[model samples]
Target: MRQLKIAVVMLLIGGLLTTAAFFLAFYTAEVQRFGTVTLSEEIDSAYPLVGVSNEGLQYERPWFSQKIFYFHVPVAEASFLVLILSAFFGVRFLTTRRKEYDTKSRIAMETALTFVALTMITGVLWTKASWGVWWDWEPRLTTYFIMMLLMVAYFVLRNSIEDEERRAVYAAAFAVIAAIDAPISFFITRLIPSQHPVVFKSGFATSNLLPFILAQVGMLMIGYAIYVMRMSEERMRERLEVAKEALED
Candidate 1:
């Protein structure tokens, strides 16, 4: 119960920080120009472009589309972190053959799935804004999609089997296998040519950096809070099941 209260407090703090980051991203962060569009003659445009001089007109891009970055990157990073956590517990379960480890692995995978879905949704929005496409078969995008499917398959694999111990072993093995793709998905952008921006290679300006860092930290806190809360709920459910069985006996 004390842990649950701490989780709630963390969740509230995370929500506040994430909200602050969102506002800072839109209001405080400097607007970045996408690229300079040079034109020989002046033309009517809807976009907020600067430099209307007759000598080679240059247009400045708006910050409308790029605002998604603040939310998208953090969610994507959180997803990968949770996926690795699930894999870690899965390995532990395999080594010890413990029910608690299996429960932890399953819950972590569930949280990973939620974040993965958010990442994909935001990725699609970012792609459409930047590339004018809702979906693309780009290396990073494709690899992440495959990872999501593998996560979905993990639950399916668990539910299909009748034997409890066998299901845990098989699911644990599958989770470890699924986790192999997470690193591939993350590093694929660095390893190959992709439309996605590499944050590590390309540094962020101070204005953007603060909000990004805040969002990242807040998101991780929220993820941990969620994991803790879910684990508590699972334990409570297990206890109820045990009490019911005892009453029946």
Candidate 2:
């Protein structure tokens, strides 16, 4: 019950922070501008070009798409964080041989999977909008793809093993390795850059930062809430198993 209350409180905080972040992103952040435009010749005067020099047209994000950056970045970060948690729990399970550890690891992995999916989706969208491509073999994209595969493999390996104890051990080993590999993949991807720039230097404006931070805090809270809820459920299930064993005796 105490754990449940803690989970609920964290969840509430996460929700409020997320809400605040949303408002900050939309209302407070300065609208990102590409560049200024001048009164041009015969072409469409309303739209501003990247290098074209124009003195008249106002420069602004052709769409509100830039706003997505705040949410996207935070979510991506959260995904990696959750993935790390999964790996940590995996290690704990392997060392302790505790069912609770396995349960926690699985729950964390599930949350990580969801966040990673979100990151991929948002990343694709951002690429299309900002880079003019639906997909590219950029370092970040490639690394994230591999991370996704590793996550999938983790589950597959778990499913194939019939014995619960063996399954947990195998999953723990895989999770640890996968977790180690994810950052390596990310780092290596950056080292061998393609057309994509190695670093994006566009610093967020104050307004944007507020919402971005809020979203991050909120997302993290939600992630914790999910883990706690899943932990509680697993605990209950364990209790039932114990009860069944008693009945048989």
Candidate 3:
């Protein structure tokens, strides 16, 4: 009960902080600009031509879609973290053949799927808003889209198996594979040419950092809350299962 209470409190805090981050991004953080807009008239000209500027209607680009970064990047990071966690617990379950570890692994995967779905949704919005298109088969986007399908396949594979132990083993193996695939997706996108922005290396303004950090922390808190809340529900379900077996005996 106390643990659940703590989870609720953290969930509330996460919600409030995430809300604060939204307002701060809107009012305090500097408005972010999209990709560099090349000027038609000033290819060999001054430094002023690089930005999304309005040089009397000839070179004006709208600075939009930057607002999505605060929420999107954090959730994306959180999703990756959860994927690692799910894979870690999966490895542990395989090592020990323990039901508890399997439970944790499954729950973590559930949380990761939820986060990844949000990442994809936000990413689509960013793509549409910035590139004026709903979708593209860019490297990073393609890798993540594949990753989401594999994640979904993990559950599908589990449901198809009748034996509990076999299901757990297969799922654990796939979770590990998915975990390996995620970093490959991220770095492979970097190694190859892609339209994706490498935000860490290119950097954000100092003023933008605060809200981004706030959103990241708040999103992780919400993630932890999700894990804990799901664990509690799973434990209750297990207890019900045990009660049914006792009645049958």
Candidate scoring better on lDDT of 2 and 3: 3
The residue pairs that clash in candidate 2, if any, are 37-54, 37-55, 37-56, 37-57, 38-54, 38-55, 38-56, 39-56
Clashes by residue pair, model 1: none
Could you tell me the lDDT of residue 239 within candidate 2? 91
lDDT of 2: 0.78
Reference-based TM-score of each model: 0.91, 0.83, 0.89
What tens-digit string does per-residue lDDT give for candidate 3 at 150-216? 8999999989999999999999999999998789777865699998877787888878898899999
Q: How does candidate 3 score on lDDT?
A: 0.87
> Which tens-of-lDDT digit does each residue in 1-249 have in candidate 1?
899999999999999999999999988897766756667866786554577666687776564778898999999999999999999999999999999999999999999999999999998998898778999998999999999999999999998999999999999999999999999999999999997778779777899988988999999999999999999999999999999999999
lDDT tens digits by residue: candidate 2, 68-112? 777777787788888889999999998899987888888888888
Model 2 regions lying over 4 Å from their true place: 34-63, 185-202
Q: Which structure among the candidates has the greatest lDDT?
A: 1
Model 3 bad stretches (over 4 Å) = 35-56, 59-62
Q: Residue 113 lDDT in model 2?
A: 90
Choose the strongest candidate by TM-score: 1
